[model samples]
Target: MLRARPKGRPKATDVELVDVVVGAPDAGHVRVENLVMSVEPYMRGRMGGEATYAEPYPIGEPMLAPTVGRVTASADDTVPVGALVLHERGWREHALVPASECRIVAHDDLPPVVHLGLLGIPGMTAWIGAERIARIETGDVVFVSSAAGAVGSTVVQIAKLRGATVIASAGSREKAALARDLGADIAFDYHDGRVTDLLRDALAQVGASGLDVYFDNVGGDHLEAAIRVINDHARIALCGMISIYNAETPLPGPSNLIKLIWRRARMEGFLLRDHLDARGEFEAQMATWIRMGAIRPVHTEFAGGVAGAWDAFLGMLDGTATGKAVVPLGTLGAGTHGGNDSLDKEANR
Candidate 1:
């Protein structure tokens, strides 16, 4: 099942558990005991044998991702024992990583996964895309696609925090309701009918003069709709394109791109890593907002055994999972109770 490059059906087939030797930190490396690593849509693109925004996962090498782990050993003085660090430890159980490559996650009132979700890369993407790029302002109208997912949920909250009237689109009625609970001014089901018609109704009801900001998470039709509804000088933040990630062939471009010229709308694409220098300021501000109940990180926890992890990932891509899709990597016999592990107990202190 292992492949040097992806062939047919991009999946997590190259899974293995090899005994990894932890060498002494070589000046810049740190040894970590990983707890949880996220399986996101971007990982699927890396396995598809295509040039992407990020590096492709190499064959016969450990798959890399942001993992929340404890620093068991350190080669750098800046990172010490028991320090909860976020690093690209890949699929393995542990890793030796460069000190500068990881962030020192101080265990505060937040859980380890928050370092991956809220305070993590996804959180930054949602925040910066909405706050800085979208420039969400009070009384502005904002629309977010994939509004029930991780980054989408964050975008909904961030837009609300800035006083923007928010509208969100989800794949199901259930997700739409959840999006409403997360402070979205309006939530529509993308599966109901023509998303364009639903968007028009939402704008008419809200009395919006086009949209001030469009936080696009899904591309293709969603992008086309946002372009048509954007007001002059509206800002569009291109976050991700989950719709086209798995297409066997390249999909068509937006047919309504001409609207950009007419509306004078600005559409810009950016990876979260580009704004690393400003992350500290953003994180600190978000932490204070979180403490004040101004923001929330909505997540869905899948409890199936390790064997069901792949199914969970696919479920997320298919738009079947609500909120932030997460499969908890817990021991099978860890607890007798059956339910989502308390988010309050594990995440928020």
Candidate 2:
């Protein structure tokens, strides 16, 4: 990201993929050639030159993300060469990350892309929001906006696992069906009409008074809708607001917020980094869920390596991706033996 896209939506033309030579690792660092890099909606905030929970992305420097790569060279004993590792130095072909910061991957039965998808940051975000923040209780009525997306998809599944009836909304009918396949009790097309009416209709069909937890990814109208009909003491797990992330001027706050005041409902925003203490538990539960066929991750892979990264980022932010979008960089996963064609077909199956 060379310059901030302050005026309008960020475009591929705004970023420059300038190459730089890589040197040997320092005493405690390991050089990792990224096999895959993630393109998520949160990156939009970092590149917008605003000070939020995350720092503004530095111009004229390599952008960063959670990257999975093989240790080509290492000066640390714990992370030796040839080991598959995960770190946060993406946006370039290779990164020299601190040994302590990298985690050794031991996955075999599952594809490595899971490190960037269901078991990755998005997965963690989903779990933390549903379990920790929203506390989605059993039999609770939960609504997740952007339910076909990486985080929202996971939230839909997790909410089901916790025995909640999930009402999911997506931009299209296909995505809504995807959410239905993921076990949502009701899935609707948010773009076709007013989401608040659709939600009210869905709840009327279910005979529920109001939603217990509104796990929001697409904010705007969705937030307003949830605010319109929340149960007493309901929770709004404020996650990504992708609908408003690229907006130049501030959108209006929900008019029905007085309902929150009247119902004594709570809306709390969270960052995944703020809840690292629960990651180990989350990983264990996610692994078991994957093993027992409790969850299936949806993923969209970009084969254009680093060059197509910008378009992939824009595509995901623009909500074109069928699932969690990522750029498959260097060699596929360590044990995974396949070309780009096979890799693309293998994901989300």
Candidate 3:
């Protein structure tokens, strides 16, 4: 659990690993042996003990996260023993979860870890942002920030599938290359130069006058750049602001707000929890895309079981992770049914 509210960037010591006794579940609950767990950027905000879309983690309690596991013992017949499940009880090897809260996952054809990455929150988030929020259209020129990361990578492919010309930016050259491989018509490293300048060059290279859609994963400079180049009636989906997730104080907003008015553009921030009603629709679409080889899962797996969860979290926050940062606890293979050769190759790198 977190020792206290972090003063600046959170440190390893802030999260202590203490042994606790695990009791048998009640009538409606089951004991899950976690197989794979996720570490995402939003989790940083939860540790701040501030009011947000999700409740903050308690000062000295187990940190909750997206986890895929199997039921070792179940009090409810609906959720049988050895059944694979998805729940939010990560940061620990085992947890007592309500059977009602457990979503039984079918992993016979796919890897169980896919429930924590490509077919889970990240994939759904991308679908919501690209299709619903941004309303990507054929021939539209789209810009995606953090295009090598989990949600951004998915957004890139989705926008491309919609027949949009995709431009992307990443923190490193290697990540930028991955973004291009993911179907970005133009991909550049944000560190190469000023973001606004790079974006302008990318747009010119693609012969696009301005952006029709912008999927923002990094805020601050990236948001400012997007606002500067948006076409009339453009839509921007604010998925995350990873650039400022660790900031100790509030950062300034985009300086180009007036451009939104001039361009008649819309910028909206969305949380995944608010869009749960569309999960079934999103899952069906993404599953088909995965089967057709139109979408590829991207993730980095840490291999120390429960002990590696913290490292995975830190790696994700520090931009060392390419897509989703996952930690494997039990012996669940992270492969995606032997389909994603590119994903397998990237993982080896």
Highest lDDT scorer: 3
Question: Which candidate number maximizes TM-score?
Answer: 3
Error of 3 at 210 (Å): 0.5
lDDT of 1 at 213: 88
Over the stretch 137-251, how does candidate 1's per-residue lDDT look in tens digits?
9988999999988899899998888898999998888889988999998899998878888999889888886888899999988888888888988999999998887677789
| Ranking 1 against 2 by lDDT, winner | 2
Off by over 4 Å in 3: 106-108, 332-349
> Residue 227 lDDT in model 2?
90
CA lDDT, every model vs. true structure:
0.76, 0.84, 0.86
For each candidate in turn, the TM-score is: 0.87, 0.92, 0.93
lDDT of 3 by residue, 124-207 (tens): 899989888999999999999999999998999999999999999999999999999999999999999999999999999999
* Residue-by-residue lDDT tens digits, candidate 2, 1-349: 4554544688666787654556678999998878898998878788777788889788877778888888889999999999888888887667789999999874635777888888899999999999999999899999999999999999999999999989999988999999999999899998778988999998988789899999999788999999999999999999988888888889998888889889999999999989999878988899889989999978888767777777788888778886688887856532222233332232332
Residue 103 error for model 3, in Å?
A: 1.0
Q: What ordering of candidates by lDDT runs from best to worst?
A: 3, 2, 1
lDDT of 3 at 208: 91
